[model samples]
Target: MQITASTVSLTVDDVAASQRFFTTHLGYAEQAAAEGFASLARDDVAMDIVLLARGTEVLPADQRDQHACGLILAFTTTGIEHEEKRLRAEGVEITMPLREEPWGERLFQVTDPNGVIVQFVEWATPPAAENA
Candidate 1:
């Protein structure tokens, strides 16, 4: 099957708060929105996002009461330091400071209003060549 689009639906306690975070900070445009739901998209990214209130009936009966937790929504990006600085200037709290991993992955993380962990990552160096 050919997939045309991708979206991550998050059940949040405050849909408006999540909506504002995505649109204001992350550059996502509001595609659609209702009382307790919002659809957001970014032209540069293929993935879209949908926010639903925790108790919204549009969700499955068993999932309606559940909220998004233990999830880290990450984006691989360039200019991570600049992005981090810009976010800081905008009053966005950095939950994790920028750091580099032994394998050359550089990253930082921020927690959204609803506790969604958003991480930005960049490769510090080219992948090591395999030794035959």
Candidate 2:
């Protein structure tokens, strides 16, 4: 079995604010927007989010929190230092500094306004082979 694509959607108080944050900082393009819903995309990936207006259908935040629903979206880049510097220069908060892990990967993490963590990773390279 195989999965084609994955998407994570969440509720936000302000659609425009969330949309702006994702589009401006994370490079997600605005795909669609309405009074109560909005979508953002990066390349072929997309997320559709909805604003919870007052209604009986709206579940409480605590109930939603009970489920294992938080997600950490990751983006791989060749220029990890450049991306880290760019995000730092723009005043984005870094949850984890760039560091090598025991699992053999260099990575860092940041949390956006909606409490979603975004990870940036740059894999280590193997040494070049010596010509015989």
lDDT (Cα atoms) of all candidates against the true structure: 0.91, 0.66
Instruction: Name the best candidate (by lDDT).
Output: 1
How would you encode candidate 2's per-residue C-alpha lDDT over 1-132 as one tens digit per residue?
898656666665555666777788877877677674666767754443343322213457554433213676677666887888888888897889998877557889887665667789877762232222
Cα lDDT tens digits, model 1, 4-107, are 88999999999899899988998999999999999999998647999999988888899999989989899989999999999999999999999999888999
On TM-score, the candidate that comes out on top is 1
Q: How does candidate 2 score on lDDT?
A: 0.66
Off by over 4 Å in 1: 128-132
Which pairs clash (backbone N, Cα, C closer than 3 Å) in model 2? none
Each candidate's number of clashing pairs is 0, 0
Q: What overall lDDT, based on C-alpha atoms, would model 1 receive against the true structure?
A: 0.91
lDDT of 2 at 91: 87
